[model samples]
Target: MFFFLSSLPELFVTVNRQPRGRICFSFLWVEGGRRGPCNPTAFAMEQLSTANTRFALDLFHTLNEKNPTGNIFISPISISSALAMVFLGTRGTTAAQVSKAFYFNTVEEIHSRFQSLNADINKRGAPYILKLANRLYGEKTYNFLPEFLASTQKMYGAELTSVDFQHASEDARKVINEWVKGQTEGKIPELLVTGVVDNMTKLVLVNAIYFKGNWQEKFMKEATADASFRLNKKDTKTVKMMYQKKKFPYGYIQDLKCRVLELPYQGEELSMVILLPDDIEDESTGLKKMEEQLTLEKLHEWTKRENLALIEVNVHLPRFKLEESYNLNSHLAHLGVEDLFNSKADLSGMSGARDLFISKIVHKSFVEVNEEGTEAAAATAGIATFCMLMPEENFRADHPFIFFIRHNPSTNILFLGRLSSP
Candidate 1:
């Protein structure tokens, strides 16, 4: 219900479902953190952000290979947070692979920094509404370690609830799914399907986060019209192209020939940065050039404070909504988290026995962009021939492009995906 999760130094209860507005998804299921200062450097939250970005890109590359011509979306932080809850109960190679995959050096950095940053983000009355939650549902008969339970509860604000996973699998699934749906504002309807948990299910880990914010500068409806989007060199589709002409932060990468533009959310607390590549002979492969040069370092360099200049830009972005789910089993195994799912695993920290291991990882996320947040604002586009007055740039996403939503204050990426067909 209305729990005042860890924000003000006065409290330390796990995340509260601070329900507010419209939806953007972040729900996770893991069949699978400590404490330190609130430092934001390579030692603390910054490292976690770095790890999150690194894993985000890695996962993006994997998803791209799997669905080369489809739109993909995910919340790495949501997945990582859910995994962190499970990380509390991991040992040996299980923890090693997780550490390596996330790029965190040690247990201290992962849990301590995660705890610090989580508190900073969960600050109450924030400009935008954000709800992140995690819970552990274990079979009432299962025997988990007291230390693991206490650590997760204190550091991650997660609580382990007793559920009849052995006898009432469907009921347990519904309860977990309902919690996820509520936390995600219904953007994610269900997190656990019929076959995910059953009589032998001993534990289920879940996490969900929701975010909704209005644009600092509105894209007027009158400026929007049906425009042809080049899905690739061959296919094309009609899309609602939202338009806006405003002075915003913009950058360009000479090597990749991609333009980066930041469309800030209301109050400028968060911004959506778009990476639109210049149309080449093979328009379909334009994004590949950008992706080839894409890295956490390059991304930071391209969007850094000094690299971007505020200029008047004519923005033509397609109105799009994306809801995606991933079964991350094969993906993680390929990423070096091998032992977590198979018989050669070790999760003894959970119960002083190696009997427990993760069976699957399910991730779901959703997002929608339009004229504004929930209401439409009107603006007229400026038209002029010669740039003798003022130079202007054009950011036309009539084709595929990559985008990321960043929490400005922390510089932590909230969401990352590409609109290939939108």
Candidate 2:
């Protein structure tokens, strides 16, 4: 019943619904220039899936703890793809650390899964527009190996382009930003700032995702009204609240003490799952507690078919929008991704010589939720910087809460956000 927006640029800023149901783990692969069905039940696939979920949960806890009082929004997929590209060039412990931190299996496995997932999501042919794009802008003089470029094009669908970063860095930045803007439908205009790319810059890896979807059971525009949103026990602000009452997939996690509601988009291939805490007096406390117990297993169990009961519920969700930007260098270092950013980094896979290292990873996100649907955009520029759920019944998101837009088939969390003020 609302719009969601997200974006991630160095200092850049910018810019779903359904029902029925969908299952997960069935993917499609392209081989011999033909598409074929592939099951996500293999050992490697399971390992990657579990690892990615765990990584998402771990990163979420960090973000939740880092910005306890403010709103937060991030595109893990975009960040992951950006880093995955860098990981392809890493060796020894550098690659191992990234693989461990991000829950990627082998480099081969990582690219293949992303390839299949990207293809499946984009080809759903549903009433939604979802796009994930990647680009690599390296210094025109850098000798990038052919093998690296081939792997990127085959697995990640990314083409490495030569950009003159040694001189005219600003122009290079502008070109990259323009490409990002075009990929994201102008939702994210400025991804890299003036100083983000300088003479010392070697390679810049970028990833962008844009999604727009309509609700299966759209909220009536006439039902929106000005309502008091509880910022905290002692503070309040007026917000435009959207109302909808209908049968929805709903669950209450007793252990976490929160309500979980799943609002499906038109095609039922994706959904926005909201976790509204039980107590609104102190919004931060409930969210903090949930973070303590949040895990991949718990998320899966809580949203399982048996746990969510169909019920006629009254929903009061605010018509809110958020645009957030983050510099993830320190945050990622704290998450065991240290080697890639420092001089000791080994990124020889991109070039035959080990002369490349990540300088910074800048991200920005935007989300808008309204009576119609959700619109979200996120851009991540590795300026060589490298960088969940619930169900329903009487969900009243009048205070701070956490939300995510997920691909139901792959169980991939595309965009995650926190609504603090709105």
Candidate 3:
């Protein structure tokens, strides 16, 4: 019974992380309006559902690799709903009508699923997970983007006079930052850091995701000390690394030539574990094997009825920061969401006869790890979903160790990162 409750969070996270099937169209409802035949509300809701599921799944998969262990928490509904509204771009009567027309049976179902998952985690004494999804049903914000832009012009010291919704401008960027700060509990920083918003910006969608949790087995500060860290084969540096030795629920398994380790978190609801190849000589093959075998199904099977042991192990990890920015227009296009990026795509429910289409998609993520724990922030923006496929590099994070922010029952990953040195 103890093990069953402990494994629940991973189960929930895993289920949430699984790639979803095509959305069922039966839930959408269309109504007559000045925009001709528009269903922006339905479209927005559907998109939110799909994005939330995908984000939850991707986060888990990335975090639950070999070599690290940690915690992850998030408000998936909040981030997904915010992104959906920005994409819809509804205004005035059309906005109000579309809001009324949109129904959320699917959202309710997801809430129910999360609630059940949370209950299992709570049984294991994990922090209560709160989604805060009601913001979506509240008053809309993007409808006022025009007014917000006008105010920006008046406040600007310069005589910048151009203000159009089709192209996102500096003024547009300011509006988005203000909105994001209000929604994300001030977790995200500089949302539009690259001046990606402008007047030609017909639609702007933003999602801010945050995760915070306590470690199951907290590391003692006295155990932390300076150590040597290898950045690569030729470069080695000395840095502070935290160390801990305890009896832990650990697993060692070989999947396609890589040794995967499972480190259970407190309450056994979640875990922070890592996978490293036995043959570090062939780093490329090791990373490929790890990725191929990294899935919720295999993880679930592995953790079920596992062996427990008290092992004397020295763990050293550094405090590090990572920030990355990506343009996701190309990624979304590859994902079959191309219509929202084209003129032919109908977003009439947002505004009457508005020739609106997404022009860009941007993503930024940051992570910090120290003796205390881990902190991370990520944001995704879609103006017009285009296509950009970056080359995949070998996942050779052959440093000290890696950590993952994960929910135990669902195995949903909030974040995944590595700590090379202190």
Runs in model 3 deviating more than 4 A are: 1-172, 178-187, 200-205, 231-237, 256-270, 283-286, 302-313, 348-354, 379-403, 417-422
**TM per prediction:** 0.85, 0.85, 0.55
Off by over 4 Å in 1: 1-42, 106-108, 280-285, 374-390
Cα lDDT computed for each candidate against the true fold: 0.64, 0.66, 0.36
Winning model by lDDT: 2
- State the TM-score for model 3: 0.55
lDDT ranking, high to low? 2, 1, 3
Clash number for each model: 2, 45, 57
Pitting candidate 1 against candidate 3, the one with the higher TM-score is: 1
In model 1, pairs of residues that clash are 14-157, 33-111
Q: lDDT tens string, model 1, 106-218? A: 33457876776667656787667765566667679767789987887778777888888667878987887687666656655555556656666666655555677788888
The digit string of per-residue lDDT tens for model 3 on 238-350 reads 66666665444434443344333444544455455555444434332224445444444454343332332334334444545555343434443443345444443444444
Instruction: Supply candidate 1's per-residue lDDT for 376.
Output: 8
